[model samples]
Target: MQSLLEQLFAGITTKSAEETERIARAFAMLVPVDTTLAFHGDLGAGKTTFIRGLARAWDIVEPVTSPTFNLYTLYEGSRQLVHLDAYRLDSGADLDSLMIDDFIRSPWCMAIEWPERIADSLPEETWHLYLGINDQQTHTIRLRL
Candidate 1:
């Protein structure tokens, strides 16, 4: 069977941060509580922007920001959001120190940035999203199930 990721993001592009967020919000409606997203992209490629849209769709009132300095940030509402940034993490051990499993096993949904930094630690079925910048400064978003 075709996977959800493959169905949702085979080829999608957005012209602005707002558009990206709108698309992300639309997709967020289909996510389950256990869903985990692995986001891959360069800086300013609209990863966080898409996340902001997700938070809005999830009805989270708090702001969404890159967790680079804090490592991870959790937002709570109807359902919890565990935002993780692995940019500074060096290994799976580093990820373990964050007690990532606790979040993964919880009712909360997770969205991880720079997931390549801890690829070994990701859940087997984690959904993958890739964001790229085009010549027109738009974002091209792809997904892998």
Candidate 2:
């Protein structure tokens, strides 16, 4: 698992943004629900794309769009994916107002972009997905999942 994680980080330094998203979502499909995944990356790092892929992979037929302006989008699949965008969150305290904690403890998978904005509120067992810019059009995808 350590080796796989290392490879994932290395991928961020070499892979295209779309490729990174594809891999991240595909990997996410393997993760069980009732888990929180925090995505750490700057703007345009393909975080939204990754979430979209995850929704599709999970069999969500409806369109998947980033919850940036909306905050969170709930979609149904074999399991539901609660996608949250923490970019506008000032602190973890904001999470409680949104009732995010309840979702985390349930049988739904959540993918949050800009997690650093609400890192403190995140559960201890949450997985971390960090994206690093390696080029103008490429990004590294690192997963601690």
In terms of lDDT, the best-performing candidate is: 1
lDDT of 2 by residue, 34-83 (tens): 78888888877777777777777788878777775688888877767889
Candidates in order: C-alpha RMSD to true structure? 3.0, 2.9
Q: 25-133 in candidate 1: lDDT tens per residue? A: 8778777777889999998888899888888888997879898678888887666788988888766544567886765545567899898998887888888889999
* Alpha-carbon shift of residue 145 in model 2 (angstroms): 5.1
| lDDT values for all models | 0.81, 0.73
Runs in model 2 lying further than 4 Å from the true structure:
1-6, 9-14, 101-106
- Candidate 1 accuracy as lDDT: 0.81
TM-score, one value per model: 0.87, 0.80
Q: Model 1 Cα displacement at 124 (Å)?
A: 0.3
